[model samples]
Target: MIAQRYSYLSWLPLLLVSSSHPQWPSSWRCIPQPARSSVPCYCSGRQTWAGSLCGTLRIPGKRKRNEIMLRYVVALSLLALSWAQDCQVANINVMQNFDKTRYAGTWYAVGKKDPEGLFLLDNIVAQINIEEDGKMTATAQGRVIILNNWEMCAHMFATFEETADPAKFKMKYWGAASYLQTGNDDHWVIDTDYDNYAVHYSCRLVDADGTCLDGYSFIFSRHPTGLRPEDQLVVLQKKTDLCLLGKYRRVAHTGFCESGTSLDPQ
Candidate 1:
């Protein structure tokens, strides 16, 4: 049997405010509490009426249900507003006039700010290529240490879907086998020098509190040794612009992926 989760929302005071009350918060409104139920209710910003004194207004007949539905509609609207605000705050500016041709090549991940469920440990290297049909594809190899301290080389492949903006792409990626990584994620080229260095950003999930719950960013360089002094400063500024300055750690490429000892079956 399914329990009515929002039934407790019927206890709220569904007051009809007069136009004379001028100081009311524009975004705040009274919503009806649901009827009798044991299921707990929760909302963003601790807005739930649970464990609090909830007053009720006596509205007879169909008007009662209508008011309850209205409350739900308003709640959903506020949630959408919060989501939009989070996106605006978290957005990072991508490259302008980004040429996929120039960007295609083997690039090394010199630094990374990993998100939740990070699979790539170190020695991260990616080879980007443009297909005959002009589609962009990538193959990434990295060293990963999983549960019980088990270590292996992770080989990943990704196909990019172009957006209206040249620098923004939706990446669908999967590992060589089913036991490895798989997901569709945003892949934004935040800023890239094409040949020397590049900054990448991706936000996986946003919370109702107008914040990112999960996100990842990378600093890539053409040379295996790492970015030059001039390029490093440029990358730092771009990182600051993306709100990820000082949030990253250096990713070492010390032939860990090249070694055969931790190799996975192809």
Candidate 2:
């Protein structure tokens, strides 16, 4: 069987909605309807390509109620030079080589980059799986050794994103950290091995006016439990093309992960 390892979440726009993959059952989660924005965005839950925010994802219609909101945002972004700055995008491969049918299951995270405030994600792991109707599921878990500050509620939820063309379909994340639906960012799946074990994530920056910024990239993989740590690291290193900002580290073992900053990393 070909390993459909290519799965990672990307940023979602406020108008769109989607999800990350967790080893989930074949049932799709019904998202809450979006609050309704004048200009909709594409969003997901996976740090990169989880899913867009909402009960269902299809570019939301511009609400008559939010028409003013849309005009204001477009005008504002058009004037900012920063908004014009190049955006961070991914060179991720949309693992189209394999049948999407094979990638329907779960995965765990074993490593990640250690940024100044991201300690909450250290030792944190994520699960990935696909639903039969075309939705994706992501179950994120983190073990914070100490309760200190590096702990937050863990989460398990299901939502929908994109899987249109296996080779061309990429992932994106959006909305509240806990709600997988709402405001969003734009992350794209830039690279993936046809075998589906490894994937690269990147996204355009989210500017002050809600526009995408320069593109940045990261390598996400099945936990070391699935791939050899050394081998996974090798694959990561080979992706030097990614030019990541920092090095990978174990997520802080915050035993409290599940719901939100208000909850824990269960």
Candidate 3:
């Protein structure tokens, strides 16, 4: 019987090549032997192929094929979703018609969302100035807590490199000494009311998964206490637009940076 089956299968390739319609339907099933015949046959539901002329064949597994296709589809969907989230975060809104001259002044950090390696902790303040060469520069001072619970007043300075857009800048900053913040980082002005409040953002690094690995944002106000109620609502809305809603903590200005006491890193 096994020899006879082998003989039947040997002619299958030739039969398939000679058939006018060689494509096999997915629903096809192989029958070992038909009810009225002593030969193997091919049947789909109630329909059977021509008698013993039908060759012995193995039908492919539909379930296995479906599983493989499903995996490919799921992987593509996840990749697309990751790209979309990255694009949404990258195309953030910024202040229109931002005048750097008008924007130059003292600003207080009223709210902050710190990322990894953040040097400034609280009592943050910044003073912006227009240099004689018409370049923008800033001095920022804040209270920082270092390793082993050591606290100190940190005075940092930054020079802005202008981009095509007036509202965006590349800030190169360093501490007054060797132990403070030092890096050239992207600085974007999300939105600013000039006199009342401002929203700033920085994306330090992006991950392979199309998400920000290290990023920070600051909500600034002209007053040390914090933003006014009306200004707060505007700043909060801008924060939400940047996808940073509920990520910030209130920054208190208790004159920590202004105190005469200063400690240098050992």
lDDT of each: 0.72, 0.40, 0.74
Cα TM-score of candidate 3: 0.65
Candidate 1: lDDT of 192? Answer: 86
Q: How should the candidates be ordered by TM-score, best one leading?
A: 3, 1, 2
User: On residues 102-188, what C-alpha lDDT tens digit does candidate 2 reach at each position?
Assistant: 544444444453322222344445555666666665555544323454444444343434545443334443322543222222323
Per-residue accuracy of model 1 over 37-78 as CA lDDT, tens digit each: 233333212243333222222322344445655887899996
**Per-residue lDDT for 1-266 in model 3, tens only?**
12255453443442343232335554455555643353435455434444554444444344544454467679889667545643354577677888889889999998998988747888999999999998999988888887778778888889999999888899999987776769998888998878998899988887776556788999999999889999878887787666677789988889876677565433
Candidate 3: Cα lDDT at 167: 84
- TM values, all candidates: 0.65, 0.43, 0.65
- After TM-score superposition, the amount by which residue 262's alpha carbon in candidate 1 deviates from its true location, in angstroms, is 4.8
Return whichever of 1 and 3 wins on lDDT: 3
C-alpha root-mean-square deviation, each candidate = 14.2, 26.4, 14.3
lDDT of 1: 0.72
Q: Lowest summed-lDDT stretch of 10 residues in model 3?
A: 13-22
lDDT, residue 155, model 3: 83
